[model samples]
Target chain A: MAEKRLMYGNHALVEGIIYAGCRFFAGYPITPQNEVPEYMSIRMNEVGGVFLQTESEIAAINMLFGAGAAGVRATTSSSSPGISLMQEGISYIAGADIPVLVINIVRGGPGLGNIAPAQSDYYQATKGGGHGDYFTITLAPNSAQELFEFPKLAFELAEKYRNPALILADGLLGQMMEPVEFTFEPIDPGKLPEKDYALTGCRGRPRRVVRSYDLRPGKLEELNWKRYKKYQEIIKNEQRYETFNDKDAGLIIIAYGTCARVASAAMKMARDKNLKVGLLRPITLWPFPKDKVAQLSERIKDFLVVEMNCGQMIDDVRMATQFRSRIHFLGRPGGGVPTPPEVLKKIEEIMGGGR
Target chain B: MTKEVIVAGFGGQGIVSSGIILAYAGMFEDRHVTFFPSYGAEMRGGTANCSVVISSSPVASPIVAEPDVLIIMNEPSLLRFEPRLKPNGLLLYNKTLIKSEPKRSDITIIPVPANAIAEELGQGRIANMVMLGVLAKKTGILQLATLKKAQRIRYKKASEEQLSLNDQALERGYSFL
Candidate 1:
């Protein structure tokens, strides 16, 4: 029998990790995202997994690096402030090419913002999330069901590319509860590619060194170029997005995660009023689906980018459209969630003939 | 068709659960649904609210700006959200907790002493269920069987005694309606 259960998005993440065969977790508790680690602590113990509450966000991410280098599925999560502390470790992990799942349940700010939901981390998440010439596969989930399903996808992408994967969730998506249909198929941990590069105690083979060190500048540059080539391949093959009502749409709204949900509502209301507005929601933020946006720009006269931050993703939209279409931006910064009416008003105002 | 609702009350008043049960029922009825709650520090003593949207098509937005229905378990919630009700919308208020009456003429207001009725039913917490019962009777949005399934699904992990109390709460709430 198909059963429906109400679960918060953080709880859904925990369930998704379990479903994805994640066996280790190391994280520091932070506002709006502490529930993820708290739930993992209890559930991990019950399932014979490991859950460690580290002293700091830096320590937590380093612990993830250690666990992931040992070739077992592992994860670490935090908010913006905590994620800032983890950037150094994230950079190291990205450099070492270790597959780890990092979840950032975003809140407001450049530093120590309020606990309210915000998408201000868009630039940080999509711009490699750390100091490196590498990319983190970022999945933006808009709802509880997506929260439950994206972790599995995150793990798959992380392992496939041997890179750090991120689920860029906002506080609103993390806290909301919705009816979710859990997938029944169990993820096999053994099915993942054996880490030939992992340091596994040197059992019977040559000791492996998992570092990004290079004695010569040319070698380091070569490695960076190879990583960029891999990213290019990802951009070509793994850009996932959803388009709604865009077949004959006059106005196209580009949004992702929580803001995308709001845009969907506005689009529905506009459609009811016989307005030719549609939505293009990006599920994969890094491999940004630039081609899809470019294709839509050909048909639509106007493109509106909505987000929880001030013109973060809009930069990417502009780059993709190459200023071909009239690009407009609507957003709510500093922990405030924009209502559907607010978005609708912005849409109408933008389309009301003032360029 | 989509029925969007906002249920608001104190933190411990089971307002979130009421929204959850309704959304679960929607799933049982093969409708796409979403339920969203206010979280973090606001969940402790502040007004707790959850938005539920049930629809024939996939739900577009989980946030309700102008809700089609308002289930208020307290005066604060009633006063706060009464202005956001669509024209001719249904308002179910817990008369025991909400002493003041709403002055909106366009909306149909149903006042029920849900807490008092639940107290008589041997538990005050079941007031949420009683409100749900009235909502079911008034809207006929989901079948009783679907609600029963939802109860089972929600209370699957609880002990038998706890499950029995929840079952009784649903029955009493339905009968009151």
Candidate 2:
């Protein structure tokens, strides 16, 4: 039998990292996401792992890049502002093809916004916030249990693609406590495939040099094309989503992270009110389940993209639907959480208009 | 049908853990449950709150806006969330902390002197557990046995003396009617 415990989302992430054989964590604390580093400090020490609180987010991400380049499972986490600081190092990691897990427990932002939950970083996460023609695999988890499980999936995908993976959580999901069962068998780090490009002592072999600087312009263009092709492959194979009561529904709601949790309640309220409202919650923000939304759009007449920001993800929904469905946007920007009743009202208005 | 609730209070008062116990009991009864907290800075003397949602089906929303129930552990919480309660919802107020009477007549207001009762039971911090006992009795949301099971699970690592005192506190609250 599996041991069940009521754990907060940050603690769940720590457990997930441990289960995924992540032995190193370097991060700077920020609100909503601070518990992850705190939990890692105590738990990592108990498990004989290294948890370093770096001087800054930039140093933390660079440490992660260094650790990941050495062929070790490593991670770093922060909220929106801190993640912004680490974007440059993240771009370097992507260019170097290093597998690192970066978790962003999103808070209200643009600048040092409030330490409250918000999905305002959706665009930055999905569209590659840093300067590059590169995309990181982004996973959005709405529940604490998914917060626990997503790190494992993130690590697997990061290693498989040799790319950085992001767990785009928010303050609400990061702070929540829920019963979680850690029944999966522990992953063995020794059993993983050996990396050929790692910096671990290239004895009696050709010198290994990892750099993004290709002095020849054509060589850099070829490298960019190679990375873009990898992103295309991920777009095809890694697009993931969860559909609830969407088979026969007329109105479909697209949401992610904390917003999805609220939308789920709205779906229930709509069901009770006898309105046909369903949900298509995307777990992967990048390589976004666009094909699934496109297919659902063919049958549904109306679509609503609900988020915590001022219509950041609505563009993605519109792009996915290709102007086929009547798409509407509802949001509460600047750290305000949308209530279920508010979402239900939108669903009712949309259904009444027959748009 | 399962009802979702949010209990708000200070950190040392056990409000968050009490919500966890209710959620645990709900899960034991095979109901879907979630407990989301507003801790950190709010926990250090500010207004602390947690939302617990229990449903017969897989819970749709973990965020409780107009909760079916609200257990206010302090005056601030009552003032903050009283207006957000659904009409005819259950409101359990700790009379020791909230001296003023509720203004609403639409909802069921149960004024239990939980803090005073816990003090009588020799543990001031267990006031939230006392409220839990009253909530279980008045709402019939969980059995006393299930509550005991939850208590044991929560305090399994504690000393026997602490467990006994907590058990006495729970029973005293439950017997207070």
Best by DockQ: 2
Looking at candidate 2, what is the lDDT of residue A70? 92
Which candidate should be chosen as best, given lDDT against the real structure? 2
Assess every candidate by TM-score.
Answer: 0.94, 0.96
The TM-score obtained by model 1 is: 0.94
TM-scores (chain A) of the candidates: 0.97, 0.97
Q: What's the DockQ for every one of the candidates?
A: 0.67, 0.71
Q: Which segments of candidate 1 are over 4 A away from where they belong?
A: A1-4, A353-355, B43-45, B152-177
Model 1 chain A: weakest 10-residue lDDT segment is A346-355
User: Candidate 2, which segments miss by more than 4 Å at Cα?
Assistant: A353-355, B43-45, B152-158
Candidate 1 DockQ, CA atoms: 0.67
lDDT of residue B118 for candidate 1: 82
Candidate 2 residue pairs that clash: none
